[model samples]
Structure formats: structure tokens, C-alpha cells
Target chain A: MILEYKFEYLSNNNTLVNFLTNIADASDMKFEITKEKNEINFYVDADEEAMSSFASTIASDLPMSVFLQNTAVSLVQEMPPSNIQADKTKQFNLPFCPKCLQKAESAESSDYYNPFTTCPMCCDTKDIKEFIVSFGDEIKRTDAYKEVFEDLASRIHQGLGVRFKTLSGTFIFEKLENLQEDKNQKDIKLLCTNLANISNVVVAKKAEIVALACIEKPQMDFRINELYKSKNIIQAKRLSVRYPNDLILYLLSKELRALGIDFLSYKNEGSYDINVDFENFDAKESLKIPKLKILEQNRALVLESENYDKKFMQVFESLKEKNKAHFMVLLYENSLLQKRILNFYTSSRDDDNVSYYAKDLEGFLDVLNYRLPKSIQEVFEDIQKEESGERLLKNYKNKYPDSIKTALEFDLSVLKNASIVSFWKIAESILGFKNSILDNASLSLLEKGPRIDYKLFESARIYNKEFNYIKLIQSGMSFRLAGVDERTISLGYIESYAHFISNIADEVNKEMELEGISLSGDIFADERISHYVHKSIGKNFKIFYNKDFVIQTRF
Target chain B: MNILILGIGNILFQDEGIGAHFVHYMDEKYEYISQKNSVTIVDGGTLAQRLIPLIVRYDYLIVVDCIEAYDSEPGDVYFFDFENAPDEINWQGSAHEVEMLQTLNMIRMNGDLPPSRVLGVIPKRIDDDTAFELSEEIIAAADTMEQTVIKHLESLDVSLRERNPQITISAMAQISFKREIVNDSGI
Candidate 1:
């Protein structure tokens, strides 16, 4: 039996596309949806069976926080004991004002719903619950979701034209324990499909979901010829259906076609595939990678590095397609070299509402951290100001007096020398550098026999860990003079390192607050401000204003 | 809970002795375990059977061994928890009876078994008869085994008794592609 029910609703503002997608995914069985404008119309077909089960499933996985009386009850109010002889022998309680027992009033229905706050003048349970506006910080963390869900449930019972199927006229019901166990999406979908298959009732996630129907699942399920496909499917030139696997048949077919694979047809209702020719395709064959590779297109080249012109260019030949955006390139921001490009690119495209998110660790930090690196530098500055730093520097100079002395101290001159760069590269590494950003970097640490020649601080992890990373950022070469080849040299290695000089220069974005300096609200919010300030100070000091992301605008 | 790790290796031959060498460090000075932390450490001494009880009792059983998977780096770490299996198409049988890929295949796809991992550190050679005569270069990577374990455990929302780890975030791939990558990359 087929039954039709419809209702009008004003689309609420807060519903996002994701919410809609979730609803569609959950209600994938029985009801078919056709969207025109913002309105969704559902067409359902099933015997007057399984309606209650369907309703319970929808009620359970509503993405809501609470349950209301209406969600479980019917719009048709239970008749108040019509045939019963009135309870004339009712016991009496303390006398109360006649007005206190007044039925629900509707002067302003939505706003007057608090049971406890019933006006001393009149009592009402008919009104919808008023919005609880004073939900504090705790609610932001949770709570408010519960209230909304409850409200929607209650609204359902308040006579909203709800339809109930007749199956010997017995209403099916469910318990909460069973619903609570349906936690994950998979389980929820199963429950909804299961419930709708047995119980003949309908349910809605929102008060707005008007048209709901439940159908039965035939044991043999041979109603296939009766079903028709939506026209939208036939009109589709492109459709994006995201699955857990990237090995999509449609995408594979397109790729196969591009490689000149021949004549294809639907193999079976289950599955089919065509073998692709990987030989010619690997050689960057006739197929050209598009500028902005369309989603689900044959192939897309993702930009992983921001230095699109140089370092990326060096490795471009390695990529199958030399020139193309493919789908999109995910760029890392930490590379001082790439930051240079982004610095220019951001300013140039600022007018186009261009937002660049660096895919690299350093780039991600520089953009997201707001002020971490700078704070690290500030901490360094604080440490430097301590009387102990002078003693440490003086002691090293006295001990070495020459090469060893210069290298022992954090000196730019000594750090720049190849010998020190090589030596400290090993020293700093041995001390601790393996797990940093430098882990992915390409650099060598040189050791000079048993005397501890230097450390090469090759990995990006160097800056994140080493206590003296800020000191090295000031005059990277001088770090070698400190007798430790402990300094970041790779343009992509340090988040704060910039390229202002002939080579990639160090730049620290030190974020901090000195004893007397004024600060912004963020400084008080967390220690993050100080850390970022230190790195900012370190990067800012090192920047010669050459790289775009680092010193994108100025020197 | 304190995590006790037993790394058995011989980096001398390339990748064979790495497990033993790694255990040497993990049981000795690896910051994750020995870093003045509440964690305990043990050295399996390239002796798998001897450490069976210890491996089974520990919250996690991490085996750092040289799995002959063709061309892999001296210290490249292959992480596989028996609970999460690789795809069947790629999971050709491995030499060991308790093949990590195979075990994981059973657990993840078929939903059988529990949690444990058999890390296959691809080495240059397995020595004459899986002897622990690691080269100086391969021996140098003993520290990485500890790092790999730390990274993997952290992904499960766990922290060692001491020592914070460095985390690297990667982009999310589609599930099927993810499965392929996990299999290939772990292999």
C-alpha cells in the first residue's frame, strides 16, 4: 500500500550541507529524496508495517542530545478516559488557587513552556519549550544539543499532522537501551533500515522532516521491475561519491580509457574491471594533466611543496606531468624557500580572496601557530639576558682562544664556515636532532675524529627541540664558531629560517613578553603566546626580508 | 601502565642485528623507556622463544626484526599490529609462521584475534642463519626502533611513562587507498 503525507516548513538557518548529507546517508532505504531549492520531499512505499521501527531508528540517531515526550508519543492525544465513570472518590490535597490548575494558554506559545515556571496565574503544558538562551561555557562544550533534540521531539507530539499506519491498530515501541547501543553510523543505518522494515510507523530527525514512510523487505525481494531511477543520474556528466577507498571503479575506468584501453561494457551487477596499460602512461604519454584537475578526473597532480618554481621544478621531471595543478598541490610552508613564493603569492592574490594553507610542517606552524616561534626566541632573549650567558660565552673563548674557542661559542662567523657547519651538524645531532623536522630533511652531520669536530643539525627537528635554536637563528654561521656545527641550514629545514643572504638565511618568528613589554589578549590566554613569540623573534631577527612567507613584504 | 619493550637485533649484517641493537638501547638508554621514566625495559637478545611469555604479557608486543621483503633501508621501520590487517590481494604469505601481514589480515578483515605487532625491519641481509652480526652503519639505527614504537603507540592515544614524542601529521587517503598504502608502506 502506498500513502502520501506532506507538510510545509521554513528551512532553518543553521543546517549545513554536511548535516543534509548525513540525513541523506542515514535515510538511504525505503524513502527516495528529490531536492528542489532547499526543500526535500520523500517518497515512501511499504505495507502498513514496520512504521514504528522506522520511527524509532530515526529518533535514535538524530544527532540530537535529548529525547522529548512527542518523539515517542503520537500527535493524536490519548482520549482522557471517555467511558470511565468519573473518579468522584479522588483524595483532596491542600487547597490551591483555581487559576493554578488552568489548562495550557497560547498567548505566546513558544516562549511559555517551562513547567516549573508556570505563571502563578495560569498553568500550561501545551506550549513548546522556550529557547534556553543563558547556556554558558559548559553548554558550548555540550548540553545545548540535548535541549534542541528534546524540543524537536516535543514539537512532534504537539499535533503536527503526524500519520500512523494501521496494522491491527497496535503501535510499536522501542526502549532507550537498544537505541543507545547504536553508536556508530553503520549501526545506526542498520537500525533505521531494520526498524522501518518491521514497525509500521514514521519518524523524523527534525520537526521539518514531514514526509516519512516505512516499507517491508521481501524475503525474495523481486519488486525490481517496478522501481525506476531518478533522472538526475542520467543527466550526470560528473558526480562525486566519496567512498572509503580511492580505488573507485569509475575513476579506474577513466584512467584506463586515457591509456587507450579498448571496448568496455558492463560485466555484471556485482563488479567489473579493465586492466590498464601502465607502460606508456608512466612515460608521461599523450594524456596531459589539466591545470586544475577536475575532481574524479583521470589523474591529478597535487602540489605538495610551496616552492612551486624552484625545488619543485628540480623534482618536476620526476613527476609524470611537468606542468599542471593536477587536482591540487598540497604545499608545505616550513621551507624558507617556498615561503618566499607564498609571501609573494599571498600579497598578489590577496585581492582574489586567496587563502594559502601550507602543507609542510613549518608552513603549517607559521600560519597556525600565530606566535609560537617568536615566543621561543623571547625565551632565548630572557635566557641571554641572564648573567650566566656572559660567563658561558667568556669561558668558551678563554678555553679555545682560536678555532676551538670560536666554535665553542654561538658565533655567526664560525657557524657559517663549512668546517663548523659540518662539525656541529654531527654534534647537535648526537645531542638530539633525529626526531625533528630535520628528520625528513637532507643534510649530513660531520664528525672530526674523537675531538667532537662539529654537529650538522640537518633535521628540522633541531629547531623544535634544541634549547639554543634561537641563538643559532641570529647568525647561523656563528653557531659553528660556537664549536658546534649545530645550526639549521636547509631552506626547508627550519620553520623560522629565511633566505635573505646569498644562501637560505635563518629567520625566527619570536613571540614573547618581556617583563616590561605590553601584550595582546592572546598573551594572557595561554603559554602558546610566549612560545610563538620566541620563534617569531628568532625568525624575524634572521629574516633579510627575501622569502615571501617569511619576510614576504619587507626586509 | 609501564611499557616494557624487548628489541632483538644484529645490525651487523645490515638489518638483522638492528632488533638486538635497538633492544640494547631500549633496555638501556632509549629516552622512551630508560629516560628516568616509570617504564621498564628488556633485551630479547635475538632470542624470540625465550621472550614469548614476556611478549604476551606486555601491554604491547613489538618485534623489531629483519623481514626479508626485498629492497628496504637499513633502518626503515615497518609497523604492523596483528589487529589491523592488510588487503588479501597484496598479502602474499611471508616466511614466518606468524606472518604480520597474514595475522593482521585475519584480525582486521575477518574480525578474529586480538592486538600485537610484528615489525619487519627491512635489512640488507639476514646473516648466515639469522645471526646478530650487524654492521656499524646498521647498528647506528638502533635508536629508530624506539622512535617508531613511540610514534605508533601515540597514534593509539597512549603516552610512555616519560618522554614526549615528535608527531608528524600526514594527509588522509581514501579507505581502499589507505589500505593499499598501509600494506605497501608497512611491507
Candidate 2:
């Protein structure tokens, strides 16, 4: 008796169909796949014993994809004729499958020790490898790639940095413990081989783990576990982690696993002991979250859209052409919006595009039409000339006595030109730290830290048709003056900023029916800020993000 | 006068790529636009500020791109001078459009902005899905836009000579979008 099994999956891509087809091809099983509007169905015919074996293999070795939402297998009475056509799904950047990995390791196999060994189940790396090999002697080409792989593994084992190409771009990798003395380690990400080891270092849910290992291979920030925190594996409370998403990293992981190394730290830029060069394969960064992408480098949660607008094209076109009051929320470089009005084009002036960060205190004060005392004006000018934050504070206190107290009493006008520089400078001065340390203060307090009450800071005040960011910054400064811990103050500032962004979005959405709200810039990569904005305004309107590009500013 | 015929758009988006494809359509079909004027055509693919230096070098600029307009249907084309752009035409529709406007403004501030005219079409589709192929509406509109740009260039004292066995816009799109050279003339 023939038994039929059906599998259902979600995702617009053909990754599942490709994987199933590969599995069927290897097992000599006949299967048929059909894609409906929402879900894809796979029908397979086999005997009871064969069916059980196939299901077990699939369960043990199914490739993780951010797109694979659900899979269910049920017995069917009738078997349909094979309608399997040539697999035309876009090739995904996936790690080697068990079968491909075995082929790479076996000396008898033609692909033995080949760094670029990959099957159709993963990516089209074989074609890439072939294209590179076509340039030179095939044997020498294989030997060179082998040498590079061996050198990479040796360097990784020696606790030295190795530079290698990923599908997206070239990266530098070193063991996390070895990079303690490395001063330029800010953008580094801890790489793990599997979810089991990843869970040992960071606190991650099952879904988050799946997202990290999925095809997209986005760097996800997670709270470092107690053991890692105590060990100080990374100085920060939260660590960004990723699993291997390409062939080179996949092979590297195998070597790392054998060496008993759980994690390796990698950054986009760094000098390394060894450099592995291969034919450039320009790979696009895949989607982290299917619909709503937050923090391009971090965790992505694939959520299904129930009310997805089919006429999004029509809406986008209409917004682009005729909508005068529509605001483009560009917070990436710095929070600024381009309000397309009649004056924007007719007048070729720079001030038409207002910057979120106040260029200078005097200019900002001038814009608000607030007349500063002659002494206070000179004091600000002196502070601006002071290069260091320490000196700036010292000179301010000496020149304008009780300035912090005075600042507390001042009613700020707009959040648009709020001094993000001033907020950071004040935090740095009080904490006796530099800009780098203070820059990460908010993110360090993301997962676990003391929370300050909202009442402590002045609520978001609307004045002169803008949100008051200066008042919020002043409140944080006052708290710092009151001897609040840096962690608590940082948490407070982050929460306040999140609410500020949400409030701005809400206010804008209320004014007119917008085509859609766009969120750009690397600043949105902050989980706290992105999450708050999404949760607050995501329900009301469609928030568009960079589809082809990562949210992080590349510069 | 030195003339620069620039087409700007992201080819990854279906109809959003009409401008980039149109320039290639022009380049492939026309060998020399005029002997009197040195005319160069460039496919400025999603580049905004980066094209400013190249644009300023030319005395006259003709930009082929997509624009959003009030009460406009897909395939509708609008031709207007940069100084006197219609209020109905919104250049703030896409990121590239916004950047292009800023680039022009920056040039104007630097006192280097050329006399520029835009030949824009109402695109039918600009979605997350990547495609090199144009929508049926945009494919039909390409001819009208091509005529408009050519007419504007000719009025600028720039003549045109069509290449023998001229390549169609659809064929050019296939070559550009797929990165494949089609041997079959029928494509």
C-alpha cells in the first residue's frame, strides 16, 4: 500500500520546495509540490517503512529558514501524479547540508576538502566554484582553496584573527577571549556554530534561536547569560550573535566544533593574521523579519500579515506624486524628515531640511526666539569652543554659575533640534567616560538594568509645533546631577527617546491620511526604539523599511 | 552645447526601473545623437548625489525618471523644466527622487546647476519583489517618453541618428534586468 504525506509551509520564496525536491532526489521518492496563495503543499508517495524513514530524515535535517512558518504532514487516500517541474526557486545562501558536509569530508569524494563545496540544497556555490576554476588549472585551484581553508582553521585555532569572505562581504573573525585587548572591537559579533552552544552564552527563546540560524543569518542582540557575564566574555551586558549562513563559515564551524571552541567574534572591519581571497560572489543581505525588519544586523521575527495591502503599489504611487504634507522619517544618519511642501522646491535653501541634532546651542536658541542673557550667551560660546567634554563642563560651571539648575528651569521649544550631542556630552562628563562608552550606555541597559520612573523626566511637551527634546535631555541631566546611576539614566534616556519617536510618528499620522510611513537610518536598529515605535504606531499605518538594503547605515 | 541625457531609477523594482532602462534603450538604439553637440547618455541606477559632479559638467541635462502626479494614471508622462516643475509632480516619491532633488539643490547652491528638464512617467508597480521586466502600462509609455526626451533634446539644437537594426526597449530591458544578451531579435 502506498501512503501519501503532505507538508504545508509559509514564505513567498521557493526555499522549501527546493529542499523537498533535493530530499526526494536523494531518496528516490516521487513527490509533487503546489503553491497556493498563502501556503505551499508538498505531496510525497512512499511505503510505510520508507515514509517513516523520510519523515525522520526531514525532521532531523530540515534547513532552517526565516520564511518556513509551519509544516504539517497528513495521510492521504489517493496519490496524485508527479507535477514536479525544474526547480526555479531563487537560490538561498544556506550552510552545507549533512549530505554535502559528508561529501566535503570524505577523501574518496571528488569534493573532498573543497572549501566551496555546496549542493543545490544550499546555494549555487558549485557554479561559482566552477566559474573560478575555469580561469586556471583545476587541480591547482582546488589545492589553493584547500590551503586557504587549512590556514584559516589553523589561525582560528591559534586564537589569531582571520579575514575571509562571507556571502555579504568580507569580515574579520577571532575568538572572543583573544580580543579583550583589541581596542577597536566595537562592531564585533560573536559567532556560534549551533543553537545549543548559543543558548549556553546568551538568553534566547526558541523562536529567536531559529531566527539567528535561519537563511538570513542576521546578527541578533541577546542578553548575555550569567556564566558569560561573570566571565566577561564580552564587556557589554547584551551581545550580538549569529550562526554560519555561507559555505566558508559553515566549514569554519566544523573546524571550530572539533577544536571545542563555542564561539568566535567577528567584525566588519579589522586587521587579521590571515586573509582568504576567492572569486567575489556579490550576495545581497536577506530579510531578517519578513514584513517588519528591526535592527538589520540583529534578530528578526517572521510574522504573517493578515491585512496585507494588495494595493500597496497604488498607495505608494499616490503618496509619491501628489501628497504634499507626507513626511519621510529619515532617522538613520540622524533623525530628520523631509516635509515636501511648496517652499521646499521653490526655495533652494538648506534650512528647508531641518536637522534633528542641534548644530549649535546659540543657533537653536535663536530659532526658538529665546533671548539669552549676555553672560549666558558668552558662556555657551565659550563652551562650544572647549574641545573636550570635561573642559566644556568645567568652563560652563565657572562662566555661568548654577547653569545646570538654570537649564532645568528653561522651557525648551522643539525636539527637532534637540542636542543629542549635549545629551551625550552631559552623560559623558558626569560618568567621567568618553563618547564611545556613553554611546553604548543605552544599549547596554537594554535587557537588564535599573529603570527610572517616567515622572522623573518632564513628559514630552509640544511647543512651537514640535516635540520638546531639549526638556527631556535637561531632565536626564538633572537626574545625573541628583546622583542617579549611569545605567538607570541611560535606560531612562532610551525609553524617553523611544516615546519621543513614537509621539512624533503619532502626531504626523494624525495630521493627514499618509500613503505610508517610512523608517530609515541605522538608528532604528536599536531594538528598544524600533520595538517601541512598531508597537505604538504599527497598528495604525503601514511602516515601510528598506527592502533591498539593511537598516544599518553602511558609511 | 554639451548635453547629458541621464536616466535614474532602481532596476530591481519593476516599473521603478523605467528611467534606467530607457537610457539603455536610447544608447542601444542611437549611435550619435548629434555632430554639433557632444551628447552622452548614462544609466544613473539609483544614484542621487553621486551623479551631481557628472551632471554639472554638462551645459544642458535631460533626466528620464518616474514621477508621481496628481490625477495621473500609469504610463502618463510629464515633461517640465527643473526651475518650473509642476506642483502636481512630486519628486519626493522614492528615496532616489528625494536624493536627486537634494543633489540638484546642492548644485544650485554651489552655482553649478545646469539647465535641466525631467521626462517622468507614472509607474504602475514599485514593490518589494525584484524584477527587471516592466509592467504592461510602463512598456507602452516608454515610446511616448522616448519621443518627449528626443524632442526636448532636438529643440536644444541636438540632432539624432538611429542605429541600423535598432534594439527595442523591451529587448533592452531583458538585457539589463537579466544581465543576459539575447541572440534572438524577436525578444
Candidate 3:
């Protein structure tokens, strides 16, 4: 078997190069494989069933619940209306990587100025010229759009923030007309130079890449293997130890069940779901039977936060008046707590309505503008300088002797793994900005700051530190959103992770022009929403921030 | 007809550092080559991550590596498309999740990826058990890279108005990982 992408199955933007680039930059899916155009290929032990499932995912065109970065984008089948698509010349040569052209999500990301040109996206002189020429042709060809695009292109060429995207994975310029007071834009270079300042970078992609490479590949034994003695090999090596996928499913399912919620394990999709009745699944189809059962409802859906409880009661109560019992708000109250779980749910005053429950930090993160750290943040200087050894750990016995034993038990190897280091460092950084610090970087952590991070909770905005067993067992939709390798998470390297979700706001911004969407008012009323799904996992349609409650239910 | 320079080798195994060494060699010895922006020097390495950032955007990709050409003598010079390259010619190994071959496979799978050619120089020894110095044969191979580069430039009809006569034409093969003895104080 071989691992490869069938081109017809992938969106134009989801090219192999782009996918690999994203994985290299942002994810940790091991067992990399490749294929020529026509055949299904596998390397590093890809199974026939898994391969077929992947192929079907591409062919079926099912909506996926992909949690990328930290944002939750409800991808639907809608592309923003196009205004000036035939005029392609103006849009020809805009740079590809936002990390370089635009500011990184935070100042800690990395320095980009004078970077080596061999960087795949760093076009050579000719490529740049080719880009500009493409831009020019699009402009010259478009009799009407030319005037609009040219100004934007010029701004971009002169180094400014006029870059935007189209539904077809192309960039459109948004020219900032009338450069307030300075028509000549004298400080263009000076202003542009800030984007490249190394000193300004607090976290960098390059460092992360280097860190990823440091972990030694897991050891494997291959004695007297005819495969190794082969003349030539096209397949990648299989891991000696395969993590138990079934065991994980069982664990997660059992955990959720223990929480008075039964969950369904979709073996092929690599995701788990709650025991919601199947007859009420989605707008397209209703489930006739729920895979699992929930206890009786209308028992006072005890919510952790009063504000969340209030929001759900209001939205559903308003809809409840209309007799819209399609589904109740999706949360259930649980009395027994192994861990403090915050939940908010809206049910029909009667017992027949459906309810949604989002049971982790992600579900509860957006209440009252709960702030999160930028994708990458600088750790405190002290933590980086800590002497995390048995010797140093023992010296702290007087203050807290318990620390010595725990420190000794800590796995230095796991800690040394660069990716893990960066992960914990990121977590530490996020913890620092929990409305805690007053630095410029910390200020960016404000809910309305440039970056946004979402949490994926079990029911609502509660964190499950002790119920780690169940969360670990049921690798759900929000698993990838945590920006960790499935293997690592499975091995229990991390109980929580955050995906660097690309904000759907940009997609919204582009839809207006590309798809010709003209919503005058009532932002949600006329918006032609699009659905985006991950290629493999068919998880629930999870929206990170809505009424600030973490509730998962049939929509 | 872009001029491509590929530096290839396993940086971890001491002597396999030749590929990176050649790249640093060019970066140091031939400063003018890059200013032209006509030649792209890539550190192909054991894994292809370094080369990835520019893979999709280039027209030509030239890789320099220490080829364990089993059939050939030590320090032999050869170029072969990896897909059709001879077997018993171990261009890849199992020390990595992402190998040079897999990376190349990815590039091949990615339509519109750049055309590539690997220049594999014969290795005297890609390990440290041998002499602790650059082998004379490897040094000679490293010197030959200059000629190959010039041949490319000549083929492209790119005349270097200020060519450095002192640099020889050879691609060297050495092993070096990231942790080198080089100090930041520039001592």
C-alpha cells in the first residue's frame, strides 16, 4: 500500500505541498507518505482499510470538522461571491505565506527580514518579477477592476497590509485609499522594515522546526528481516510498536459514560460522539436512534457559570416561545464531579427537547471575553533558566519536600523533546496571560487583540484536570485543535493541546467580494455560510465562541 | 535554466557533514553567486525540511550529497534521478520519520514541484571511525563542485563578470549536525 493524495479529491488550496508545509509548520502527524497521481499508495505501514477510508472521505465530499490552529471554522459549501475574477492580472503575484507578508499572530513568532531566499515561498528575483507581471496583466486586462486593484497592488509592492484572499485561493487587494496626510507615503520603507525586525520577534517558526527535529526517532528492531535485505525499497519503515487505537476508544467512551453521558466511537472516522439521538443529527438528516443514551432531562441542567446558564436560557427561551423544539440547547447538568466541570444547557421546559453539552475548557473559553494567549508567547525568563534536575529539585525539600520526589519522577527525555518543550512553554506562556500580566505582549492577550485561541470542553467552559482518563480515551474533534501529535497524545504526553486555528473572519471578509454576498443588516440572516470538514475525522460541528457557552448539540 | 546547488548528507554521522560543508563553502567562498540571485544553494540534508521552504517555487533543484554508490570506488562522482537511480545505492535510511527519499517523494507528488537532480559524490567514509580529517579524496570531490557549478552557469549563458579564480569546482561530502564547535562571540 502507498500513501498519496488523489488530486481530484483535494481542493486546489489543499495541495500536497501546502498540506506538507502546514504539517511541517503546524502539525505532528507522523508516518509521512507520498504517491504519484493515480494509485492508492502507502508507506510506513498504511493499511488497506485506512487507505480506502481516506479515499472515500475525499470522494464523498462530506463536510469535515477540522480543528486547525486554535480556531473552530464551520466550513460549509459556500465561497464568497467573486467581484472581479476575470481580471486575474492584478492578483497574480502576491506572496503566499501570511507568516512572512503579514505580522505573525504574535511578536514572539520569529524574525523574517533578510531570510534566505531558498525558503520555498521566498521567490527568486525572477519569480518575483513573474508575480508582478502576472499582477500587471490582471490589472491591464481588467478595464474596471484595474483601477481598484492597481492601487492595492502598489500598496502591497511598497510593503503594506492590502492583502486579502478569494474563495478560489487567490489574493485580492484592499487598497487603503487616501494615505492620511502623507500622500507620498514617505515612511513606507521604514514602516515596512518593522515586519522584518529580528529583535521584535519573540517566538519563531524556525526555532520550532529545529525543535521538532531534535526528538530521536522511536527505536525499532529489525533482525533477520528480508525486507531490510531487499535490493530496493519504496515503502517507509513501519513502527515496531503500534499504539492501541481500540483501547483508546474504549477508554474515552467509558469515561464519558461514567459522566452520565454515553459516547459513540466511529472507528473509521477516528472520532467519538455523545449519546445523542441519531434521529436529530443534522439539518440534512436526523438519526432514528442515538448510539448511546442520556439520563432523563429537565432535571435542572446545572450549569457551572451563572452567565452561561443565563445565555442558554435566553436563546432557547426566545426560540422556545416560537415552539421551535427542533433541538434543545445541548448541555446537561451533572451532580457528581470527579473534576470541576462547568456546564450550561437549554432544554424545552418540557422533557422532550434535545440538549447540547460541550464539556471542556474550549467550550467555556469565550464567556465574557475570556482571554487566551497568542499562538506563540515568550516564557518568563526564570522558567527557561530553571535547574530542573534531581539535585536542584532535592534542594527545595525545606520549602516543599514533595517537589523533590515529583521532579525525580519527571521524564527528562520527554521534557527534552523540543516539540514538547515548545508545547509546555506555550502553555506556560498562555497561563501567564490569564488576565495576569501588564506587558505589551500580555496586552495582546486581550480577547479582542489580534490573535484568538479557543478551547474544546466536554460540556461547557469547565476544565477536566482529573477526568483526564475519559478525555484521553475519547479522542474527539477537538483533539487535533490542541496542536499535538495523535501518537503523543495517545502515549499520554499531553492531556490538552491547542490548534492554531486560522480565523474564519478572513474567510468572511473574502466571501463578500468573491461570492458577491451583500448582507445589509442582520449579520447572520443572509450570510451564505460555508462548511469545511477535515479530510478524515467526521466530528461534531463545534463553534468555539457563541453565547460564550460550551455546548455541543444537534443543529 | 536556473543554477541549483544542493547540499546533501546526514548531519548526525560526523563525516556525512560534507553536504552542508559544501553549502557553507559556497556561502563563504562565493558571496557574489547569491547577489546575482541566479543561483540557489540548498541544504538538502538527511531530511528535506530545509529545502522545503523553497521547493515549490524553484525551477531547478540541485542536490549535493555523499552517495554510498556501492558499485563505484570511493570518491567517485555521479548524478542520477533518485527514482531511477540504481538499487544497492542506499540514498535513504531509517533514522528519521521524514527521510530524503520520502521528502523527494512528497515533492514529486506535489504537482508543479521543481525539477530536481541529485549530485552524489563518492564517500571515503561517512562516519568518524576513519581519520579525523577530511579525506583527500573527499577534498578533491568537494573541489569539483565548482566546475559542475560553472558548467551550469555556462549552460545558462550566465557570465560571471567577477568570477573568483581561487575557488575550485568540487562538491564535498561531510557529516555535521547542528551542534558545531562554532562560538557566537566570533572568537
Predicted structure with the largest lDDT when compared to the true one: 2
Question: Can you write out model 2's per-residue Cα lDDT over A287-326, one digit (the tens) per residue?
Answer: 2222223343333332222212233323334433111111
Model 3 chain A weakest 10-residue run by lDDT: A518-527
Ranking by TM-score: 2, 3, 1
Off by over 4 Å in 3: A1-555, B1-4, B32-37, B49-53, B80-98, B109-113, B124-136, B159-187
TM-score per candidate, chains pooled:
0.18, 0.46, 0.28
DockQ of each: 0.01, 0.01, 0.01
Docking class of 1: incorrect
Question: In model 2, which regions exceed 4 Å deviation?
Answer: A1-54, A57-61, A67-99, A105-113, A125-186, A189-195, A198-209, A219-241, A265-465, A477-484, A497-520, A531-549, A552-555, B1-187
Candidate 3 to native Cα RMSD, angstroms: 29.3
What would the per-residue lDDT of candidate 3 be over residues A340-420, giving only the tens digit for each residue?
221211121211111122333232321111112222211222222332222222222333344333433434333322222
Error of 3 at A211 (Å): 33
A272-388: candidate 1 lDDT, tens digit per residue: 111111111122111111111111111111111121234433333343421111101212212223332211111111111111222343421211110112232243344356433
Candidate 1 chain A minimal-lDDT segment of 10 residues: A214-223
For residues B82-168, could you state the per-residue lDDT of candidate 3 as single tens digits? Answer: 557767577543232235666677778867456676667766654222112455676777657656755655555554443344543
Provide the lowest-lDDT 10-residue window in model 2 chain A. Answer: A341-350
True contacts kept of 3: 0.00
